[model samples]
Target: MASNSEQKIPTMSRQAAEALIAEKMGPDRVPRKFKIITDTSDFFRVDYNDVVILGDNPYWVKRYEKEGRFGLDDEPKYWVRRAIDLSDGSTKILKLVFHEEFETKIGGISIRCFRSPKKEARILDLVAEHPNFMHGHWVLDSAGNNVRILEFIPGPRYDQLIIDYGTDHQDYFFNYFKEVLDQYIELVTAIKFLHDHGEKHGDIRRDHIIHDRECKVNRWIDFDYNYMHGESMFGFDLQGLGNILIFLTGRGDVLVPELYQQQREVFDRLWGEDLNISYKNRVANLQKIFPYIPKSLNRILLHFSIGAKIFYETTDQMLFDLAKARADVIKLSGRTS
Candidate 1:
């Protein structure tokens, strides 16, 4: 027999919890744009136990310090947690940007730079039609803080997929490589859609690209660093894509240490010498290091990496070349089959 205190207690499942929250937070009160959380306090409750306070709270600061969580400094800026709507039982990811005051040489100033969440919301709105981007659900405000809720995407990071499938499996490398290349092409297509609409995803990295294997969908997230329309923004993103391709090809530092080390030395010597000269030298070094890359694909990668031949002046050009490369691979596969 178990003691009364040791008896198991039933807990609500996530669905039941969300349903209860939704009932509390009336659907009528939910706004299309961001509103302060305090404004809707009558319908929602904050669970303090599971919250991540990003502001300058001494208690939280000390707690995070004891836990050895990185990025907690003397001055912090945001708080993040999950909240439930009492009326409808819907759960939302909440972010709170704090208000601050500073003293400068001239005088005292109050700064409310809580616009990042709003900016992200706006970007999401712009690219809402595209399935590859995350959707912004709502924005709320309370007191002097701003809150943003985004649709949560569930998947593994692009790099994680490479790690799980790329190592200790030379026989499957080609298949995996083709799959990655196909995904990369789709990413390029999505980025092109953004460019066509006059927007730029400033950050493009392996971690930012999430792929749902079951659904066969790729979502690009973390638009906190996104940029507005600019003539050169497309080129900047293209360069990032080139770097991502290099990473996915298993030629990065972790996968091929000796080759990366050699490339690093060359890159170090040419650092800041001249942008064009350095890019050209690095691409040339990569060609020598990763000779397994198909010649056609190598040329396409070089166009983006070096920008000397101007083979990919636009996203369309790159996509066309990629299609051709895929077709060539298919033909070769058929011959072997």
Candidate 2:
């Protein structure tokens, strides 16, 4: 009774199989010999000294530090450090997840600082075949820590592109916008691939999407919060995609607190008085606020964002529409040029 698709399930490699097993068994089951990478620079050092090697021994950790400080904490704990691969003598980017007993309460439950590098590694392995996903070179596992060696995708972050070219240059912005639309279609294709395999990217923020100018491809990164095969979180990824489109259209300024407050009265009246409006209604409000969105694309966006409409039941459906929109833009651009 096996369908052709089910019968064609590819055999997982030994390493990938081991990673899945290790993930299911948790961090405690990871091997002790496998070294875990950690940040040990003067500014911010990981507290745990017994388990892993400090990555910031002699190398410059300046560029590796992210922009914002972690919470009220002054220094950055998590870091992306360069490590020399002993097997090949080449350098690789090691993503270190180091939290120093930071605790916070969420939804009436106390949560402690914890890293899920194994889970991330497994998810990376699952999506490795996808062109848009960043490859996981190797996973180093220790009793208390896990280190993932990810492919160092060289490119400017999507947000950086928005900052550099989103405004002040009308022609360039339109060209870049077209490019972003193409990239968004490609992203939808990547997400379709994930959904086909029964996985969902739980987090799909703008920063996580990188446009590699060298490869001319959009790479999706950070599987830290990815959800494995599940039915409960079905439409959340669609919502994330909608947000990304809104950002790409340069209307992200509308998401600011002041702007949101300005539109709150109209939003409530239009979408009814529900304080916690649905994702679809939220997107509909976005459509209402930004009436300048092109008709061809706005239809697609509204279909995905509006609660009552169900035109895009799957990522493939959305992908098809996006591809058409991209092609239409290209044709229009050609004519204008």
**Cα RMSDs, all models:** 12.6, 11.6
lDDT of 2 by residue, 140-214 (tens): 322223456666677877666775664543454355667767777888888888778766665666777877777
Least well predicted 10-residue stretch by lDDT in candidate 2: 1-10
Which ranges in model 1 have alpha carbons more than 4 Å from their true place? 1-47, 50-91, 97-115, 143-146, 166-173, 227-231, 251-257, 260-287, 304-313, 332-337
TM-score for candidate 2? 0.61
Best by lDDT: 2
lDDT of 1 by residue, 59-148 (tens): 001011011112353332234445443333444445444332332110122211222555555577777777787655443333323345
Shift in Å, residue 184, candidate 2: 1.0
Per-model TM-score versus the true fold: 0.61, 0.61
lDDT against the true structure, each candidate: 0.49, 0.53
